[model samples]
Target: MKQLIVEIDETTEARIIIAAKTAGLSAQQWLKRIIDEKTVSSWPDSVKALAGSWQDVPFAEELRSGEGREKTY
Candidate 1:
């Protein structure tokens, strides 16, 4: 596994230590869990179900197709 280093203020470090203790994990483990959560590659179900749902809306193609640029004088 690769290693990473981060520099944080004393107050923030203290907060992480306290949070780790509350969750019964070491500070390194708690930080790793947070990084894993933020790096997940999956989207939520609500957003996944919205695919192609707006294709039929009025002028949706013209508004989003990037083909109509304003002419400058």
Candidate 2:
């Protein structure tokens, strides 16, 4: 819900536009998703114990507990 002014390479911007359209999403939305993925959360491993039923185990958790979070189904 905020406006952002970012500079991208001309060719890269065009490629993002085409890829976003092919994926049935707007360019902004596609970029937001990518940004969200690369930005790691600061949540500690102990936080997982507080996250009830939360899946997708954090990388930190995998190392501490030696229990990877892979969907059984």
Q: Point to the candidate with the largest lDDT.
A: 1
Please, what are the lDDT tens digits per residue for candidate 2 over residues 1-73? 7898988899999999999999899998899888986896877677766865656656665666745556575
Give one digit per residue, the lDDT tens place, for model 1 in 11-67: 999999999999999999999999898998999889999987997676867677766
Predicted structure 1: lDDT: 0.90
Model 2: pairs clashing at backbone N, Cα or C within 3 Å = none
Clashes of each: 0, 0
Q: Among these predicted structures, which one has the highest TM-score? A: 1
| Inter-residue clash pairs, candidate 1 | none
